[model samples]
Target chain A: MDSKLTTTHPMVTADSQSVSSQEEIVLSVQHVKKKIGKKWIIKDVTFEVKAGEIFGFLGPNGAGKTTTIRMLVNLIRPTEGTINICGYDVTKQPEKALAYVGSIVENPEMYPYLTGWENLEHFARMQPGVDEKRIQEVTEIVRLDERIHDKVSKYSLGMRQRLGIAQALLGRPKLLILDEPTNGLDPKGIRDMRIFIRELASQGMAVFVSSHLLSEIQLLCDRVAIVGRGSVIAVGGVTELVEDTQHLVIWELEPQAQGEQILQSIPSIQVLDLESSNLDNDTAASLRPHSIITATPEEYISTTIATLVQAGIQIHNVRKLSPTLEQLFLGVTEGEFIE
Target chain B: MNSIWPLVQNETIKIIKKKRFYVVLLVLLVLVPMFTYAQMRQAQENRTKFGEDWRVELQQAITDNQNSLGSDRVPEEWKKYRRVFVQQMQYYLENDVNPNEPGGVTFTREFLDNSSSLFIPLLIMTIASDLVSAERTGGTIKMLLTRPIRRWKVLLSKLITLTMFVSLIVVSTFIISYVISGAAFGYSGFNIPVFTGFQPGDTGTDMSSVHAIAQWQFILMQMGLIWFVGLTVGLLAFMVSVLVRSTAASIVIMMAALIAGTILTNMAASWSTAKYLFMVNLGLTNYLSGSPAPIEGMTLPFSLGVLAVWALASVIVSFAVFTKRDVLN
Candidate 1:
């Protein structure tokens, strides 16, 4: 773990200026709560998205991620607490606060009847300091120059998403809030979006992306907050959240039923039952018998191996499993549906 | 507020690009010609029947209206209308200016005054009803409201755009009517005198209450007054657009209100409260032509005041509702 940390932490130090400027928080959502009629939709949600970082908001379905995003963009006001964007309270001074913030909530809902250029031109007029050059620059960044003249109704979903991103980038916003930016994209489109988002962060813009794709969040985000039931269950770096404190060791042995009985006799180790009922006859006949053994803090794997060997069990192989994001997410969310 | 100009420009561009304005122009192109042809045929029939004696025709109209006024079964509203018609015929007879002259300017002015009450309002509603509600339906409201500008500014820009298109529709109607009618009726009545400013009680030929204005001045003033009424209709439709989420609903509601107003004005004059309805007073051009009000006691100033209140109240309510309403998907 220390060796892995040494290799990865240097990437953080390479962008030393950005790392130092990370102290400049672009979005601060503190104790935010929203109640619609009789039910509380968001309960005391708090998080900070810093500059030059990709902040992932991971949550299960009905976790209030969109509600929180809507509140930040001033689409819906927070019932309690405050959301500050670039040091301005969203509720009190939305115009000034949201001046430097660009957002795409849910689907990139552009006017389908208008040409892509017309849609961008119309949105550009709404924001101050967005000139023709800025529009061209953003359109180029989104790689929409060739098709910008075409009506948006003719564009594919991927192209529409790109146009949406271009519109959001028009004002050179300090904080870009994209709710499910990669939704409905092919694998290549998703990859391109990932690269584009990283490039935007490299330009010192704080990006707050809310998504339920755990692997995409794991690969794309620098830090993430896992939300469940309208509350932040965990907030930490991606690697930190997935790092396991305890290791799971699997041992394959001859006559697994006898080995399980022998392992159950030891007080320091807990033996896991291998359910053979689910396996087909051909697979069950050809498969090696395996048992999962939990090693206590007081005992070593060698001790368990020695105990298994002394009980007349022939051990064929031993392996240890590293925790993955999928396992970590399941553990954090208790196997609830993320979508 | 300073950013409102670009917003207005953006809105105006959207409206123009949607091709809805061209629909108005196309409707005018088709319908105005048909109406002009019908009017030409009627004028030819009048000439064949009455032998082209302007004085005799004016005297006949005056006598007919006076005969209607003497009827015991005539309703009070029709009586008022007849009285105004008799007075107008008397004015035409005395001034020696033919009211039914087959000329471009005369036909255009009459067509404008006649259409101002219903046709212009319908056209304005077609554009105004979709201003805000269409944005909502198109999902563009999400893109619009997500910007840094205030919500009121967005609604104001729509209002401004609606006003621009309303003006365009009105001017286009006039130009189309004039050009089309000019083909049938020669364009040569620029200097003819028309009488205006006759009050409710005064006879139409009462020179003390009425004054003579050139044909061109009357057309300009009539256009200006009709523009006010068109703007009022647009504002009311804009209010409906803001209140409703569906463009179809907004257009239907405004159209129903307008059609109902005309029906009520014709048949429900006994309901005194109908005088205060916005549609009852939308015929601001009638005042310029010295035509009797749809309801009794609705003077030019009173109608103008009623329309002003309606416009002002619609704008206020629109701003209030739009600024606070949630942009729910």
Candidate 2:
């Protein structure tokens, strides 16, 4: 595959300091800052998307993901910073720079009066080299051939989503930015979108997808950037992001208060607060009320269990809880309390 | 700039598909016949009064205006208007040409002159005010601005599209008024001699510059001036559309301004400075018919200058704001 060539040749890159693979960087945002009115909406953000890679941009609400995407497409200007798409600056040379980019910001807002095919044709005319053949190819790529002739006002949300992607791909851009790519899709449609995105990446297109679906990002993206409060807090490989967190094990015991107190008193044991930690709502609620969490390694947990038993604690359950991307996201965006 | 035509085509298709153009045509379709019927009734009333000869009708109208000019009950403004009408009628009678012969060309010329200030600009504003604001309201402006082109070029295309449709609306108004009215008034006056160039208030209806031209030629110049008025109003509406986010609000604002212009033209004669206002200068066809200027010094070139400046300023503001403003939403 064309993507494999990118991974095979590992080269040390310039100052953006991304992964070791030698694929050309398709998008680079350096110290981008945007001030809206008197408030700073995007304080300082920086990252890069390489060719043939699926980059996930993770952030909670008001994290400036949509703003950055608007800047990438030159719909909004960055107050202070440079965003280069392909090789040209998006703000300074939007015609030359945006030529290599396709994006859908908040919604795929096409003219409702126009048909899906007409919308594609309208966008195709703006770029330099797009033609009728390319419009048809994109329509086929998004699997909207059956409904492409219908007016967009009649399209369902999922159909409109597909049409949005079709128009985004009309220019055959090197970089494709999708905000909440799987937002309005059913389970089957979501699976198909995942495969479709993978196919685009395999053809050496850099796909930047901003989503709140952590599991989707974990399964699909090669690398990810987690944004918090208008800045890039962390950027790394998906698996590595999950691996870098502190390990933890859950224990259920009678007189859980005594057991947790005794464990906290022990010099070698570290107790974690399950209630106020807010690691994740589901993860915290899944544990019993009397259960306690400890970050002690398994080999050393035996001593802690013996000591808790001696303190009149009845051991009901003990199991190692693996770290998931959801826990990692909650911890990173909130404060990374696990560390 | 080179690719402006395709963008214009896109805009045109969007408007047509949205049925905005059709609505304008529908309005003309419904209104022209009523006006034509009214004109037919007036012609019938005059026929019974003067019996079959247009010359006799012309003679009687001149006598009536001359009598009104001498009456003390006529306001000074009304007296001035009748005085000019009587002088112009005397010249037409002396030259043996009937100015208001009942026909299709005469109907069109009358309709255009009367509608220039309000009816025609109102139609042009419907399309222009929705040009940019409708896209914003629909949230499609993000898609429009994201294309791989300069922002100014996109706006220029929209301006060009507005100009094209403005011309279409004006030309169609003339055609619709002529064709529909011709059915009732008889289509027989394209080559009839028409008197013009009798400058009101200059040398008391000076017949020295009063020359006779064909009625069709007079109608062509009338259409040309009306088209400029429509284009100027369209540019102002386009500017409002760019500055405002809601299409409905833009339309309302432009409509209010146009209605105010019509009102001001009627009562702003003493304001003096009102002469510089584009609305007061909207009677450009009046220069062709030798009607008194709304405010004393508003000649053809002066009104054209005022409209030109308004159109140019609107263009500058529209482009500056459109290109520089951020798409915050």
Candidate 3:
């Protein structure tokens, strides 16, 4: 889906036009640093989230993702540097800077005793110009209208997440920040949240989602920044980050022992043994002993296949492996353990 | 700043919805009636033991105090107390008024005046002690502080809401006490005369300061005075709530201080400095009722000044800590 496409909904479109102008930056962090006691929690972090985009913040555990987010939301002050939201400095004028921002820091915790509608209404009262109609609209947008009257304690985790989003969406915020928005969601709930967040971005709201779930972030975010050890290691479009690098090409051939020896003779080809048995018995028997081979230039796949076939080994299948976000993350972080 | 009103309104709603307030109301609901019933039974026994003539009873009480004054075994403090009692008893006897009347308004006024020192403070602390800390535990403080409002404004709104609720609880206590006790003891005595300003001086009762006021007027003044003390207690608890992260700790600390204050007021006469403690001055109603100050040389103005300083310091510290501290979960 093209998340950049403008929706036909009048309210959303009007909001999009008024608040988001294509490339306008909604959130900017410049050389932000945070120190707690003697240790640096966030070290020289800097990034920007543009209008009409889902910007994913990916990091290993204890990598300062939450610390950066807290500074952006003004829950804690940065020891150094400035954060501007919609042109207002967060430290100097937090009330004005945060006026256009809505966020769920870690969990969408609310008053468990209060009903979902009451929670929305309570937060709505915190911001100006958020009336009953806007509350209803956001509630419907989250598909929580049917259960909005129930107490938050009774709502499932997925429902609580939706209600939290509804609360943030009140006042039609220009920037919606969700720290681990889908932390405790089921597969269907995660999918629903991904689509809903994209829909929010399409309506012109900039979303900053921080998560350890690389696959979800890969599918949901238009742009992503990976942070490791208190610093951002990579930032760009997901497709560009994954596709801009060299990858392996696996060539499956018949009579694997003969095919391996044939490919071994070629100086350009590198054959890696299968580390573990991943193939099912039926595919293994039907395919009749195929081995894996890699071409260094990747474009040499045709030559490697031709060379193998000429040596009397029948080529059964040829597959090119594209890098996934997980692979890219592991590669960039040097296989660092992610929590 | 323009959103302070809505913020205050929201806070008020949040407080009222908590089950703690209902628990407070329930305690009051059961407590006042039981107290009034005991008072009624005591009054009945008094009538049965000493005939129905309040004048005769007043004369006998004065004679007994006069007799005690002649005894050398009485402590100097009791001698001073007996001297004031004799003078006040004579005044009541001359005026043909019964000071201890078994009626709704009379019991309420007396109950509030007596309990202001401890019970009322305890109830107000229940609501105030959790004002900020409960939000932290429930994780709602993040939601509240992250809004497009200043932290001071948010804390100020909570303070204002606490002031409002303290007033509400005080008024409700009176109303609930009156209604429940009135059912048992007839709702009369609104116009009954109650005397004030019988100060205990170095020698005897300070007759020059004595005066008389109706029971309703006395109750109103008592309510106003107790409300001030309650607000002071609430403010102190508010500061503790901000400083401490747990609701139970805040309430316990405040309660411990108050309970210690009551004990100190009786025994800390020698300490002298104990009179300056904030909790010591919480009995503001004592001044209106013309009761002797708990400590020597501690007058109404002195107590008020001490309480004012405490309240001011609490406000400043609470705001300073809350606005600057990092809200880590």
Q: Which one is best on lDDT? A: 2
> What is the per-residue lDDT of model 2 for residues A1-339, given as tens digits with 9 covering 90 to 100?
121211112222233235343567888888889999998989878877898999999877677889888888898899998888877788998888888888888888898888999988888877778888888888888889999999999999889988999988988888999999888789988999899999999998999999876678887999888776788777778777766554577888777777777878977667877653335567677888777887665467788778877878899988766655445655455555233
The CA lDDT at A217 in model 3 is 80
- Reproduced native contacts, each prediction: 0.68, 0.74, 0.78
Clashing pairs in 2: none
Index of the highest-DockQ prediction? 2
- Candidate 2 docks with a DockQ of 0.67
User: How many backbone clashes does every candidate have?
Assistant: 0, 0, 0
Report per-candidate DockQ: 0.52, 0.67, 0.61
Residues B1-329 of candidate 2 have per-residue lDDT tens digits of 25688898888888898899889999999999999988889889988998888889888888888888788898777777778888877787888777777888888889998998889999998899989998899888888888788999999999998999999999899889888988888877889888888788755877678788888899889889989999999999999999999988999888888878888877887899988878888888989888888788888999999999999999999999999999977
Q: What is the lDDT of residue A47 in candidate 1?
A: 74
Residue A181 of model 2, lDDT score: 86
Ten contiguous residues with the weakest lDDT in model 2 chain B: B201-210
Kindly report which residue pairs in candidate 3 clash with one another: none
Deviating ranges (above 4 Å) for candidate 2:
A1-22, A246-275, A279-339, B59-74
Model 3 docking category? medium
The full ranking of all candidates by lDDT, starting with the best, is 2, 3, 1
lDDT of 1 by residue, B1-329 (tens): 26688988988888888888988999899998898889989888878878868777778778888988889999877788778778777877887888777788888998898888899999888789898899888877878887887888888888888888988998999899888889889878888888887776634434467888898999998888899999999999999999999999998999899888889878876688899999888788888777777676888889889999999999999999998876657
